[model samples]
Target chain A: MAIDERMEGIEAVFLDLDGTIYLGGELIEGASEFLDRLDHRGVKRFFLSNNSSRSVSQYLRKLTRLGIPAREEEVLLSTHDLLNWLEAEGIDDTFLVGTQGMGEMLEARGIRTQSKSPQAVVLGYDTEITYQKLSDASMYLHAGVPLVASHPDLVCPSPVGGLPDVGAYLSLFETTTGVRPVKVCGKPNPSMILGMIGELGLDVECCAMIGDSIYTDMAMADASGVHGILVLSGEATAEDAATSNVRMSLIAPSVDSLCR
Target chain B: MAIDERMEGIEAVFLDLDGTIYLGGELIEGASEFLDRLDHRGVKRFFLSNNSSRSVSQYLRKLTRLGIPAREEEVLLSTHDLLNWLEAEGIDDTFLVGTQGMGEMLEARGIRTQSKSPQAVVLGYDTEITYQKLSDASMYLHAGVPLVASHPDLVCPSPVGGLPDVGAYLSLFETTTGVRPVKVCGKPNPSMILGMIGELGLDVECCAMIGDSIYTDMAMADASGVHGILVLSGEATAEDAATSNVRMSLIAPSVDSLCR
Candidate 1:
């Protein structure tokens, strides 16, 4: 089925960045046009990224630079979900392994990120991670402190093969201390976008999840009772989608074919 | 049975450091006296440690400072076993995650410790580990480079609980890239002390391994055909050895009771 036909009753569509919108620094072909189509059809589109390295301001700048009209409100990140979960769990003190961009975001929300007696260790996509962070985190884990990850991505796709992400770090921590994270926030957790779906008064039947990853995007859609549109312009191929047990409501080469 | 009774026909005894000889900065009670007893009995005593943080010279200095007369030749380390394995496997150029002491040891053996394109990544019990080393190793692993570990001890027993060691680092690497070491060359591998047993022309039956860790010391003894003496001075408790399937020739509170 064509994405236009499948997208008929969908009022809000969640979009994944990186492989879904762009690969590396270059924008995906027709990604901007796809946004324009969503706007023309009076359909709401929200950009969702599991990458915790950048803050909303950084993402807004990147999207603006890419010839895409995106507001701060239209962008959602895994960091936001993590922060929410942290607040919900009443955790104010934490030892964090993340970039300054992510640190600023956490600090702004009243969380002590470098606590000596932290309640938990917050892990993120730390491009500027240090040896000190890994060792400190390992020591804390050895001492029985729980860990929380922003996302579960093993590797972030790059022009090169890929780079180790939170998932990889989580594996390392689990390996070192035989301890796994108590909670992992972000995509496929249902609450990442489902809370917003409820706030917008959108019925589950009128919501759609569009992304490249079946495990994260499609899986979230499945859990949240929303339609899942799998895009194959990223890490996953058509063969992977077909072979996977995940249910993808519609499959398109890219958003380029959507509504055409 | 008393360790002295079990030691009747033993020609040589491999004594594990840390819990067996000493703990942290202090020497274990009766440890030096046990060495004196070995000397009086005309038995050879070799000091063995899986700690990769300290070189043989360092170990000699530590033992000497602790008032135990130990020669450089009397010390055997996991790094030595790892170096032997690397040489046997023809792995020269490699990236290393270890302290300067370990790096110098590898370099002295004509192995490059920071090669970008290398045969393997060497994991050790590095006290001065950094994030750059970890990320670089992860990248190498992502590219399918093999990893080699010095030993499999998860924690270096410290006065305050314990610190993460090569085993922990190995776990981290295994978690990050889903790649375990092609070979871990220490302790239970048996090659650590077995080669020395051969060089000494001592029969395995006449050899004894004395350590507090059953997994490494006792396991190695089992594989190398030596008597395993379980000591309750370090990581293992009386109950741990009691519940374990590992066989022990004798169990002592500490090396304090040895040769009495």
Candidate 2:
């Protein structure tokens, strides 16, 4: 089917950040134009990312600098997904093992970032991870303190190589204390986009998920009952989409090809 | 049988450190007197340990500081066993993930403690563990550098509680990269004492292993065909030994009650 034909009745687009709109500091060519086209089509676009290392404000600053029009409300993150889960569970105090940025984000949302006696241990992609943080959190787990992870990504892409992420840390904690996370909130959970679609009273079919990763972005799109658009601009290639069992509504070189 | 009855044929005694001779910074009650008794009984004593964090010199210092006379030659360590394995396997260069003392122990014995291109990644009980060390060693392992650990101890006993040790670290690396140590050298392997017994030209039945831990000390004795003495001055209790399937020659409140 043609791109426009596949995109026909979609009222909203949930877009991934890294590799989708921008790769590192440079924006993907025609990404801003694609966002402009979404506006012209009266389509609501939400910037979604699994990077819990950065708060919404930091993401907003980066998006603005990259020339992508976005607001705080227009951003969806694994952190927000975590906050929603914690809120539902009636937890306000936690021992967080994450970056300073992540701690600030949780504290700003009224969750105590550091509690002497915590109800749970909140984990994220802590780029600034330390041994003490690991030991402290492991001890907590040994003492039966619950663990909640923002994402299950094993490694983050670095210029040098893949660096250990929360998934690796989770493995460490489980190994040390014989305990695994009680809940992991992030992409592939589908709640991040599905909750938003529900709030907007939009049918899931009226929305489409666009990103480079088949495991996360397309997987979430599939579970949320939304249109899945696999793009080759990021980690995945056209060959990957062709070989994968993941159902895709469209396979484009980038968002540049969509809403054209 | 009486205490001396159990001690009848033993010409040498191997002892565990952390729980047998001392706990934390203080020597166990009657421990020094027990050493004196062993000397009077004409029984040779060797201080054995799975604690690779402390070099033999450090252990000597701690023992001397505690007023228990010990010679450098009388100390046996899991590090020695690891070094023995590395020597036999012809691996001289390694990326060491351990404390400064452990590094010195390996480096002084002709092993390169830090190599850009290492033959293996040697792990120990790294009390001063860092994220950089974990990441660097993990990357090396990911690049196919085999891992060798000093011991398989899950936790090191402390005044407060058990602390995560090399066993936990092994699990972490395994979960992170699907890599396990090619060999774990320490107690219960029997090599730590069996090698010494062979060198000394002594029969295994003429030796006795005494310690507070049933797993390492008693298990080593069972594997090496030596008499097993379970002491209650450390981690294990008489009741634990009673219920445990580990065969023991004797169970005493402390080492002081032995060899009398």
Candidate 3:
């Protein structure tokens, strides 16, 4: 299918937030117009973010404040996937090294964020990471406890540049304890969006995965059998997408131009 | 030359400490006997260790406590190499993430170990590492300061198992900043032993590098034209040496068997 033609069949869209809709605190140009176009076309759209530092409520507030009003059901996070994974594995106790907001999300799900005898060590994008957390996690890992991470993004896109993310934290653990994460739940792991897609009664063929990062967004689309759409409004350049093996169904300059 | 034949011309020995001489607090079986044999043979022996958390005086104290009877001049440490490298580069200002003992050594050398405007981030086997140290190191690395590590040993051997070392800390910094060390001064670097060899007016071919690790001791030997001797009392098994690419000139059951 042609780049523009692929959009015709996309009845539902999974949109990445940070790079696609906004970069840091400022909203991207044409993002609102693109969302309006999706609304006009009766396309079901959902906001997906791999940043586990913020909870769903925080994301809702941020989105609303940015003029892109999002309901609770319409926003999905890696934290949700982490919660689901923990529940399925019967993991009620974990030593979590994440933000206060992330702590609340885990606690609300009945997962103890700080257990002395934790079954596993759960890692996230912890901007508030401390030495105690790192030391404790290393001790648990050395004791043969499994590790679970929220995502595998090496760096998060920022206005200044890339900032360390969960992937970097995972590397630290690996070097310290010679242990790797048993599970990483987020973008590039198809289950992040597959559950929501199933719940929406959406056909996989008519669903498009859209984002700025080729590795996470496009790779997830490939894994989940959704139409991968690459937006150049963020981290990845056209040259990057061209050289990458990921087959993007559509390559747009931005969501606005694609929608227009 | 045959494995035993290579030892015939050896006039001096460069011995690794942790696995070769002592395992934690206790000396390895026959370690004393091995040293006595080398002493009887009129061979000069130097203790070469990649463990940089301890200074030379601390190592001398530990050696004397263990009944090894080591002199200050007979001790060669990764810290010595780090100091030499710093001096060569004329770097007096560094952000050091190491032990208090290591801090004292750098300070004595007229090097600022805790400068806000550091020329480099110097890493060592810091058992007393704090989160503040790690966070500060990451910030400096992100700000484009070059990283210089004392050694590249991932884990230090302990009585029970392995403990995190400078290499582990280096991994953490790499993940957080996407930066690797500009220089790593320690075993297998050749310069660690080469300088002493030149000072002693000893031929490299007449010296034997004996240790338990093939990657460090034997690899250093290969790089500096010294006879490589492998002991089976530490990290590498006989099976491992059999499959490895590093060519060892001799293999022994332990330092005892090699000396005898």
Candidate 4:
């Protein structure tokens, strides 16, 4: 609630990677120090990203390269939520439109990602998309196969700018077959950090969700009853936060300014 | 615009082929007879389509095979409008994400369809879409190249069902690049039929646009000052027409019932 008391009871910080801590390969100024402060203060920090294009390992590698040092457990991707949903639905067969790394993750879980006769069509942030994949996915969807997407993000932030993400593809599918995704797994859905918070034995009230996106990060925090700290290092500007329906618990220039 | 005066003062008919004359390979019931009536009555008929996947020659051949006896001049494709727009804008180089037929049409018009460096991104209903084409288009759009689509039909009606069309691809591009088409050369835009009417020296009020889709066919008629005749053999239904904003001049189960 209060600005100064925002992080008063917080024990864990669910930090958004792209906009909160860094943009592209470069870390924001003071982000390293902010993370160091979290470490020193005994606050558990986990990277949360709605971007499903990159796998957990890739995120870890990127974080390490950027000197943000992260472990596999400290990285949370939308793919994990997708896997959880797939397992829960008892859907072992799927026609996945995702990257090779994502395929590997699904295959590791005994889920066949390229079944000829799939029960569902699982769409992710498929950057390496082909006409064949799109056509096949459309064919299946037209045949009444339910659709599940990794996330609802219309665009993924890149150095070049926002690229069409799974959300855009979903719109394409909707236009083509008049079918929409039955479920979308990612931030703003609450379950994203909620599951992690429960497993880590952290109080929901004491868990702060820090990110630049007000819709996803702040919305998730507000929905899940977690402290939402809006960062201005990325997409959401102060003007955006002022007009947004999803109210942020605290606002910081960037994670670099937090715990300073 | 009364039901009995539907075709009373009509001197020409701008008919939509896919839904009005035929569905996929099979001709609609009484379609040939309806065309015969139009010919017998000396009403000039031109087949209109928003589908740019096929060239004029391809459409003529298909119509011939389907026993529609269509000549080259009788077919008015969205591709024609696309060429008109491109030529008017003095564009000679383009990156086209379309079928071979559409590419051939563009190339014949002295427009380079596949230049490494393009002035514009011309999108069509590409059934033979590839990952490379999409990626290249995305790259160009990201570089701030304007996008021009052939048409905005979400799905192409097929024997199997609805297939992904230009509208679907447009959504993908919009999602990926946040750039919408600067120009869409198809129905609902009065210019689509207005130009043809001007060329043919036909009175716009004396011409009728007959098709199934209310959004495209009827809306085009309403916008272009042509009598709008709706056929229920394809997309629009009686219930749809009843609730739609576009005022229909006449409603029939098929074109067969219109002149009868």
How close is every model to the real structure, measured as TM-score? 0.88, 0.87, 0.74, 0.77
Q: Which ten residues in a row have the lowest lDDT in candidate 1 chain B?
A: B1-10
Span of 10 residues, lowest total lDDT, candidate 3 chain B:
B1-10
Candidate 1 per-residue lDDT, tens place, A1-260, comes to 32353378778999999888888888999999888888999999999999999999999999888988688888989998999999999999999999889999999999989999999999999888665787788888888899999999887765534567888777667766778899999998888998889889998788888899999999998899888898999878988998999876888899998865
TM-score for model 3?
0.74
**Candidate 4: global Cα-lDDT?**
0.86
Please provide, for model 4 over A201-239, each residue's C-alpha lDDT reduced to its tens digit, 9 standing for 90 to 100.
Answer: 877877898999988889999999988899889999999
**TM-score, chain B, each candidate:** 0.95, 0.96, 0.95, 0.96
* Location of the lowest summed lDDT over 10 successive residues in candidate 4 chain B: B1-10
Instruction: Flag clash pairs in model 2.
Output: none
Best by DockQ: 4
DockQ of each: 0.29, 0.32, 0.23, 0.42
lDDT by residue (tens digit), candidate 4, B24-79: 78999899998898888888999999998889998888988988887888888889
Error of 4 at B42 (Å): 8.7
Collision pairs in model 4: A164-B176
Candidate 4, residue A216: lDDT: 88
List where candidate 2 sits over 4 angstroms from the true fold. Answer: A1-6, A22-36, A39-42, A57-71, A157-162, A198-201, A233-247, B1-6, B159-161, B235-247
Best by TM-score: 1
- On the 0 to 100 scale, the lDDT of residue A146 in model 3 is 93
